[model samples]
Target: MPGKPPLLFDEAFLRKLERLSLVARRARSGYFRGERRSTRRGQSVEFADYRNYVRGDDLRALDWNIYARLERPFIKLFEEEVDQTVHILFDASASMDWPPHPAEHHKWNYARRLAAALGYIALANHDRLTVAALSGDAFTPWGPERRRRSIHRLLAFLSDLPAAGQTRLVPALTRYAGQTKRPGLLFLLSDLLTPEDLRPGLSTLQYRGHEIALLHLLSPDEVTPSLAGDLQLQDVETAARQDITINATVKTLYRQKFDAWQGEIEGFCRQRGIHYTLLTTDRPFETLVLHFLRQRGFVR
Candidate 1:
């Protein structure tokens, strides 16, 4: 697929796009200005309730008219509310730097475009956004503020992310789960080719009350290994290689294994009520964002 326009991450797109909101099917009751019904109601202009204001409260909301007649300094404070935070966890690993062959696209490039488009969409809609690269050690994951003004910060954070090293999804995810105190939407984008099982990692985040959404990016070659005869398949990240003669039976077995792996992942996500979608690098990112994702309710 052709690469996305660099302007996809521009501020103009965000300003025009913020009107569109993703209707989260699962209950996510934090805050947002959108008219969508929330599971938890709080202090918004929509009017939830009123309580006595404490010290250091905004005095403008004080019921001056009430005080003039009733002789009481009753202040009206709007309920605490805002948009839900959209936490985007992108995988920047060496495996994602896999080269494109023939009609296939680069994995990292595809991921980057998707990340940028999604971030823009979220920011445009007045939703809070946190874009992080969880491929490093338990260090700080940086990104723009949830507001629309932080467009440059979000772009820089994504552009500077390096695609290198082996991925330890469990450690990275567990660390994020520990640090994040608020419950919100979480999207994990990765090829998921780590040596370790990814289930434990995903489960950790899910247990933290996050609406887990997994975007599995796979290359055409990885899904269907077209190698035949004597060949050496080298691990792109580890630099390890295994030499084997590819016969029809071997090819069949590999296909079975690949299918089984995909099935296992799909089953795991379904069982946990997590949203899972697979995207091949060869497909257009716009199609994924505007069509496939909308069908999945990530956009509307």
Candidate 2:
């Protein structure tokens, strides 16, 4: 609790979330009624189809004009609104907690803010929302909270998760997919510096019929190197050290490698139909959520 950062959102920010809704990606029918449109007909203003009126059918739905001409009663059917379950998983790895420099923004904290904002969008739209923390430890999942009133519980759970341990994302995802009875959308926020290949976890989620979006988080130091002289870079999880000098040539190569990595990730996600976005802690998180995310079809 002492090390935890406050969820960086205010009333105005939440108001923005209220204004936006997740892009209407076709999702599986939910267990309970929600605000999103469903395949089945229910009671919305949008008229879909009509059928011969049954004795028990609501009289309000009767087509008076058609009945007057044909001497037959007909009922109207409107599209149903089904709930969507939005599951957001935060990579609580040690690297996420360790910023490359103290002055640099905290990756874990920024990730928390992004996760909270997205979760708020779901709950505010009356969609079922679940936030989960993933590491080598057992997965810690917060509620499938529904509606705006559940925001406090979502905020509380998101703010409390600590970024620690190695990233066992694949195992955690495998377990989750196995247990989940209904399919929904999933947003994964992580640096993705795992020892194992990330493809397996992503593929598993996709195979489970989930619309997956991976928002890869990075720090300014990670995107570029401003350091001079020789230094030892330590791996936060394994404590493994690599000693190197920060020469101009080395820095240039570093930048090139980083660019290449981004390209490879984008290519991979594109091939797999995963909505991949690169987010840096340097820029405004709201810009990514409100502008870039919408542009990429994450929200509308």
Candidate 3:
């Protein structure tokens, strides 16, 4: 009987971030001529490097004096400048709908809110934004615009995404891994209920020069299930079932596995210099925007 709750941030929330720009640990391509230096540089008054001139090269870029004296053709090569794209990959899987009995909020609803909030942040900064739903190896592109006005489009995209299918994170990510030639930022929001190996897919993105960030979302009940007796642990997405008894040792083992899994994910992100954060849907959107994400350099 429950439906998607209204998105958290309104006009007021967006107004507070109108003057800000997207921030990253390392510089990335972007618009508006900001202070953060991008990896892709051009003839923007910042000197990059020099290379030997080749056929069809710009004659003006040639070091005339070097060619005249040393009889060598050389040209200056600045970083290739381009706008940064913010790719939001939301896992639209059935498992995201699973919640404890009588829960007020669903995992998918929480994930949508966070995605919308992040979309607003990126839109306010004039960064190119795209929202995609991962169903197996398919990427359903949502918002592919580059203006503040596209925020509404993004919201609509997230609002209507059906909570269907199983999550195949590695396959979904692998599909677009080498496709995007432009280096940008990838924001993956999910409960991570996938059997797919995320490392290989993530590594592919890194190889293409993308700065990846993971936003792991979960519900309070998922962290602490209420089953105090024998229970059937069903895979929400895959419909696979596991029967088990709930006892002190079982609960302890479950919690340990959860902690270890999260720690391993954190360590993986750290090793690859990817920004990572874990959030329960119960938290406020503003808290994530103003605190957790800010600490990770999302908006500055």
Which of candidates 1 and 2 reaches a greater lDDT? Answer: 2
Q: Candidate 2 — which pairs collide?
A: none
Using lDDT as the measure, which candidate wins? Answer: 2
Estimate TM-scores for all models.
0.74, 0.77, 0.74
Query: Which of 2 and 3 is ahead in lDDT?
Result: 2
User: Model 3, clash count?
Assistant: 1
Please, what are the lDDT tens digits per residue for candidate 2 over residues 1-300? Answer: 137643355676566555554332211122122224554433345454454565565597699999999998876545343256788988988889856433337888788878887777666445668888887834788887765678878877877777776878889888887777666788889998776777887898889988888899988888886788989988888889999999999999999988987888889999998888888888876666777655754443
Q: Which candidate do you rate higher for TM-score, 1 or 3?
A: 3
For residues 162-240, what per-residue lDDT tens digits would candidate 1 score against the true structure? 6777778889989888888765777789998886888888888888878887999998878877778998888867889
Shift in Å, residue 167, candidate 2: 1.2
> In candidate 3, which residue ranges exceed 4 Å CA deviation?
6-82, 100-105
lDDT of 2 at 182: 64
Tell me which residue pairs clash in candidate 3. Answer: 41-79
TM-score of 3: 0.74
**What lDDT is obtained when candidate 1 is compared to the true structure?**
0.67
